[model samples]
Target: MIDVLYFAWVRERIGIPRETVTSEAATVMDLVDELRAREERYALAFADLSSLRVALDQELTEFDTPLEGVREVAFFPPMTGG
Candidate 1:
């Protein structure tokens, strides 16, 4: 199982903070496809991935990054320095 964490507006749209899921996805993009297919909430939350950033095991990674050996993943809006 992987720990999926949603931050900022991703959580607001999805209405959840985090979840643990078992998936057959091999990469972050694959996982995204799965989530996008789950329901409207997921689809809406992931609709514009370009505005989002991802992390794997707490380290920033690309959407195509493999999920192998990854225990955690986080999704959030692009952070801006104030």
Candidate 2:
């Protein structure tokens, strides 16, 4: 199981801050494909991968990063300076 976290607008769109997902995905992108298949909210949230950033177990990483032994995955929009 992986703890999937959503921040900022991502949380708003999904209507939840986080969820625990049991997946067979080999990569972060594959995990996204699973979530996107679950519901329209997930589909909308992940529609534009370029606008989002991913962190695996609290360290920044890419969507293609392997999910082996990972415990957490977070998704959020890219940070910008004010």
Best model number under lDDT: 2
TM-scores, each model vs. reference: 0.98, 0.98
What residue runs in model 2 are displaced by over 4 Å at the alpha carbon? none
lDDT of 1 by residue, 46-76 (tens): 9999999999999999999999999999999
lDDT of 2 by residue, 25-57 (tens): 999999999999999999999999999999999
Pairs that collide in candidate 2 are: none
Candidate lDDT (C-alpha), each = 0.96, 0.97
Spell out the clash pairs found in candidate 1: none
lDDT of 2: 0.97
